[model samples]
Target: MNSDLLILDYEPAHQPAFRALNHEWIAHYFTIEPIDNEMLDDPEGYILAPGGHIFMASHGGAIVGTCALIKEHKGVYELAKMAVSPRAQGLGIGWALGQAVVAKARQLGAHRVELLSNARLRPALALYAKLGFRHVPVPPTPYQRTNVKMVLDL
Candidate 1:
């Protein structure tokens, strides 16, 4: 593989890969399913709702990572659903996808970004912090697994 990952918008054909990415990490860190097939198939419904955008990282011909940006408030965006294949971690694909999301947010005229994560995901939290995301108190949500909230000012 070239290893030069290209980040692009969600496409119907890439849903399987995206779902696999989500499932893999969810299985590792949380007991619940992160995303179901139906949700992946209906990208526009859940993933793309709230003015959100999905992105995937492709290297050679395979999708290796995925991320999403959801509109939170006026000029505020929520960065969500970031996952990299286990085989693809340590290759900077996660960072690539994150920068892509930030660039996407900039392109969309967003002023800030935020994300929800679990304390169990230390690597991901470290990566977000390295990328300038500061931790905030966790929000009260139905999802019990989430323990940290990260925010970034663009």
Candidate 2:
């Protein structure tokens, strides 16, 4: 736990790590089945596209966490795809990544930042609350898989 955790922009070579993080998070946290190839392929375009940024945290040269910011509307961004490796949890990595994304949102002059999460993700819910994200009764998502939506005013 004394190792330095480096946070930097996502790299093309780190796509597999990012994919693995996403897959594990969704499957384990959401209790959903693993993603298929098509779903896995979807992140490539976003990770490599403009108007979005990916930040990753590495410990001991291993990618332990990742977070992404994608433009949602005129003045809002979606804080999507945040995950920390199970072995690396409870180390404040998620809080650091959350602050990084909020800083990025402010840099972009975003009015608000939003994220969706499942009700069962209590740790994430607490983290979001600690970071000033207020829950909304209804979310903007069409999918019913998520029950909690929180927005941070920037």
Candidate 3:
């Protein structure tokens, strides 16, 4: 990771950057679904208000990556909306953000953390695996693009 890269908590000022980063990645691989719009449009309502958290990675004073842990009932969090700017892809921003979110979930007393992803996103899946997430049976999901599910026990 870059020595200057910092993972910070989300604030209202980060709304546009958060949405743009996520939209850029999702649209590149799959169609943006209604659920994506709902979450991206009002992260505070759908995520933070429910006791979840969002983390942003800043490098050279620019937002370069983001990740979120959405509370899903007691002691469970869904790792979602992770993205790294194309320019920052090789700087380990994604790993830093992922570690931050997982650490946050554990700090919040989460028993498990799960994520929904696509098989085609091999790099992401590898990252998740490296973070201690293991493949699990895919549950029905709102996003048409999701075909892989993984979980990490805390």
Order the candidate numbers by TM-score, best to worst.
Answer: 3, 1, 2
lDDT of 2 at 36: 31
Error of model 1, residue 10, in angstroms: 1.1
What does candidate 3 score on TM? 0.98
Cα lDDT tens digits, model 1, 73-98, are 88899888798988888888888888
Better of 1 and 3 by lDDT: 3
TM-score of each: 0.89, 0.88, 0.98
Instruction: Please list the residue runs of candidate 1 whose C-alpha ends up more than 4 Å from where it truly belongs after superposition.
Output: 1-3, 33-41
Greater-TM-score candidate between 1 and 2: 1
| lDDT per residue as tens, model 3, 7-101 | 99999999999999999999999999999999999999999999999999999999988999999999999999999999989888888988999
Error of 2 at 17 (Å): 0.6
Please report the candidate that would top TM-score against the real structure: 3
lDDT of 1 at 25: 89
lDDT of 3 at 12: 94
Determine which window of 10 residues in candidate 3 has minimal summed lDDT. 88-97
lDDT by residue for model 2 (1-154), tens: 3357888888778778887987798877554433433334566575446477788998778889999887887889988789999999988889888888999889988999998878888998899999899998864564456788899998
User: Looking at candidate 2, what is the lDDT of residue 55?
Assistant: 86
